[model samples]
Target: MKILTAVCVMALLVIASAAWADAPKRVKFTWSGGEAVAELNGSPSAESLWAMLPVTVDFKDFNGVERIAYTEKELSAEGAPESCTPDAGTLALYAPWGNLSVFYKPFRESRGLVPLGRFVEGADKVSTLGEAVRIERME
Candidate 1:
């Protein structure tokens, strides 16, 4: 009985891990300085952004802590959390203004900010991206 139980547990774990591994990657943002890849969360807003991939936009520094870009189209904020506290490399959508925000420094919790994802690489270069940035889906 013990052997059978262990085998079942191990099989379940393998299946779960396989499913996770097969999940689709999110997006990558590139600029003159460097590139960063973000692993998006399972949120409506994130999905909306994903649908508009391979876009180019201009980014500007904001509050000395992050970069802000106008997405032209507003993302869905339904089912998003009421508030979010951003840290370095955090990516989010500012619902009120319908802009995309990428943090390079920690900030206070605020409402109407929808969590998107975080930079998995080259986060340090986020603060140095050129005015023009290209975002595309990662395979």
Candidate 2:
């Protein structure tokens, strides 16, 4: 019985883990400066947040005027975050003159339903809410 239980558990983990491995990665790109901390939290639980997913699209060069096709890649338990909490990744469709800025922050006190595809995930490249995790965003 114990062996059967162990096998089942291991099987479940294998199944769950494999599903996430195929998912699109949350690409984070951080540069050297920012003066504020941002978030996405509308609720109070610590479980509801993503901190500082980064991007590199030279927002300063645009003089802060641009538009973008933003998106959110919804994830699941199979894609259990490194924090073991569920979360989603954001993708901004922008270039220097066309794309505005990028910002990934924790879910904070006043977050709203902010759109996903046709809407805005509100990733402001101005918030440095969390410590930077080293990563390479392949263009």
The models' CA-based lDDT, in order, is: 0.89, 0.31
Total clashes for model 2: 13
Number of clashing residue pairs in every model? 0, 13
Task: Write the residue-wise lDDT of candidate 1 on 1-139 in tens digits.
Answer: 9999999999999999999767856799989888998988868899899988888989999999989999877799989999999999999999999999999999999898889998888888899865779999986
RMSD of each: 5.0, 12.5
In candidate 1, the residue pairs with backbone N, CA or C atoms under 3 Å apart (3 or more residues apart, or in different chains) clash, namely none
**Which regions of candidate 2 fall more than 4 Å away from where they truly are?**
22-24, 35-60, 66-122, 126-139
Q: What is the lDDT of residue 36 in candidate 2?
A: 27
Cα lDDT of model 2 by residue, 2-116, tens digit: 9999999999999989986543333333446533222322222211113223432333322223222221322121222222111222322222222222324322221222221
Best by TM-score: 1
Q: What's each prediction's TM-score? A: 0.83, 0.32
Give the TM-score (vs. native) of candidate 1: 0.83
Off by over 4 Å in 1: 1-24
